[model samples]
Target: MNKVIDINADMGEGFGRYTIADDERLLDIVTSANVACGFHAGDPRIMGLTVEKALKNHVGIGAHPGFPDLIGFGRRDMSLTPLEIKTDVLYQIGALSAFVKASGGHLQHVSPHGRLGNLAVKNREYAQAIVEAVLSFDSSLIIITEPGELAVEAEKRGLKTAVQLFADRAYNDDRTLVSRKEPGAVIHNQETVLQRCLKMVLEGTVETVSGSEIEVDGNTLCVHGDTAGSVDLAKEIKATLIEAGVEVRKLEEWL
Candidate 1:
């Protein structure tokens, strides 16, 4: 059997009249979609349409929950207790789950968005809260995250987890992503992105910004759909992986 990997993109981020990214085009290329629930972005119409499109394309649907910070796009840090975080996450998941069920598709995974995602990597309290939230909602939901506290906590709670590698971002020596505010954080060059992805998948290592190699295991790779040329990048990455004899499939298949 050939090696398999999943390609996921953050989608359904538009809110009402304003839209971001070509989610339709992305749905054609990505194996899974991390849809933005109402807390951060996306409204009821966007969510329903996104779920419908994803089901039509046979792509896995995932809930992308974030802090209730629409003005900051959920990238800004928020001060909230563990219980608050858990309840917020549960609410978002429940909203998306209803849409998925209505569309005849199942929720495949849960990926915390923006700052919440960053915190989950190192904050034990936040990680545990996210894990508990997912378990309380649906224990079968796959937790998509990097190799960090979130993944560790999710696995400890007996919830399925999928390690995700970023295709368009730079990494630090510690495997955390470089802050978007920093220089050269988001890699826009297609060649550089492709090279990094191939190396990470085949070699199981990534060269950090500090010029050091670190072990990085990933079952899935993510490309931010809101970025320029995201659909093109996804297409190229999927084609390259398939050509290299790596099966590009949904995370659900592997789990």
Candidate 2:
């Protein structure tokens, strides 16, 4: 049997009159797109346009919900109760769902963005809140996360879950991502990123920043759209996976 993996990216992360990465080009290289839902870096127009583009490319559309911190780009931790987190997640999902629906496409998954994403890994309360929000909106929506509290709780609650491995980000011994504030947290060299991705996908493990290897089940490989040369990196990664006898497809296709 051929190995299968999903290539995903965080996209549609720009507000009105302001843009981020080249989402239009990135969509062509990725199989799944995690679209921002206005809380972090998207607006209604961007959401609609993103959904439409994903549909046209037959890419999976996922809701990327984050904290209500536009200034911080949802990367800064915010103090919020579980209820607040749950409601905020639901609101973002709903906002993106409408645009997806309008484009005749159904939302495929949910991934908490930035700080919300980092917190969901170890923070039990935040993890549960995010899982609940996803289940409440759509029982079948897949939760894209790592093998952490969020993935555990989502699976326990009978929600579909997909393990996402970051190709350009450094990881800690605990399987959590290294902070962006740390040097070498985000790998920039395309060759290095490709090698890391290939190792994670083919070996079922990743090397941590501490120079130790840990098991990693990467159902999906994520490449941040905001990263420089992301499109080219994604293209290379996908091609390399294919050349290695791996199947590259959308997450929903197998999950």
| Highest-lDDT candidate | 1
User: What are the per-residue Cα lDDT tens digits for candidate 1 across 157-229?
Assistant: 8999999999989999988999999998999999989988888888888888999999999999999888888
Could you tell me every candidate's TM-score relative to the true structure?
0.98, 0.98
Q: In candidate 2, what are the lDDT values of residues 1-255, reduced to their tens digit?
A: 888999999998999999989999988989999999999999999999999999999999999999999999999979999999999999999999999887788999999999999889889999999998998899999999988899999999999899999989998998888889999899898888888888999998888999999988879999888888887888899999899999999988997
If candidate 1 were superposed on the true structure by all CA atoms, what would the RMSD be?
Answer: 0.8
**lDDT, residue 63, candidate 1:** 99
Candidate 1 matches the true fold with a TM-score of 0.98
Error of 2 at 130 (Å): 1.1
Stretches of candidate 1 off by over 4 Å are: none
How does candidate 2 score on lDDT? 0.92
